[model samples]
Target: MFVKICSKSELPEGGVFRFDPETAEKAIVVCNEGGEYYAIGDKCSHGNWSLAEGLLENCHLECVLHGSSFNLKTGWPDKRPATKPVKVFTVKVEGDDILVDIESGVLLEKPDA
Candidate 1:
């Protein structure tokens, strides 16, 4: 099922929002890149750092601790220090609401451990 995380107005262009659902095990990071919405796992694949605390340039989110940049569209890390990709979730904008399908999260690469 899709959950309403925030309104479109709340997240301006090139903005990021972190949502932690009480029912979920991991938090989600919602990003607005040039008016497009993308959702991915909040934690950095290489470290326990929060992706929301990192920088967003183009469609990639860079981890502040290790400088590992992950593509928001595919969840694959483009920079080094990170081998595994983070989970990506389906995002949909309905009217003024931004919804995320937490149940449909997919990890592009499996973790080694």
Candidate 2:
């Protein structure tokens, strides 16, 4: 199932928006690169830093703490210091509301292109 995160207007081009659910166990970071949207795990795999607070360059999101860059599409570490891949969430835009599916209880696999 998808949860409403925020409005589409709130996320601009090359912008990052952190979405928190009712529980503190999970958080999602959504990125607006151009007109498309991509959602990924908010926390960095290698550090305690939030990826949403990091720099966004194209599809790569750089963690300021360790300077690790993760691909928004696949959640793979494109740079050093991060060998493990983060979770990539599915995003859906419904009119003005932006929804995200955590894909919880699902098996880890290659992201869809």
TM-score, one value per model: 0.91, 0.87
**Full-model lDDT for every candidate:** 0.89, 0.81
lDDT of 2 by residue, 15-57 (tens): 8999877543477889988788988888788887788888789
Put down candidate 1 lDDT per residue, 7-82, tens digits, no spaces.
9998999899999986234899999999899999998888788889988998999999989998998899987899
Off by over 4 Å in 1: 23-25, 109-113
50: Cα error in model 1, Å: 0.5
Give model 2's TM-score versus the native structure.
Answer: 0.87
Best by TM-score: 1
* Highest-lDDT candidate: 1
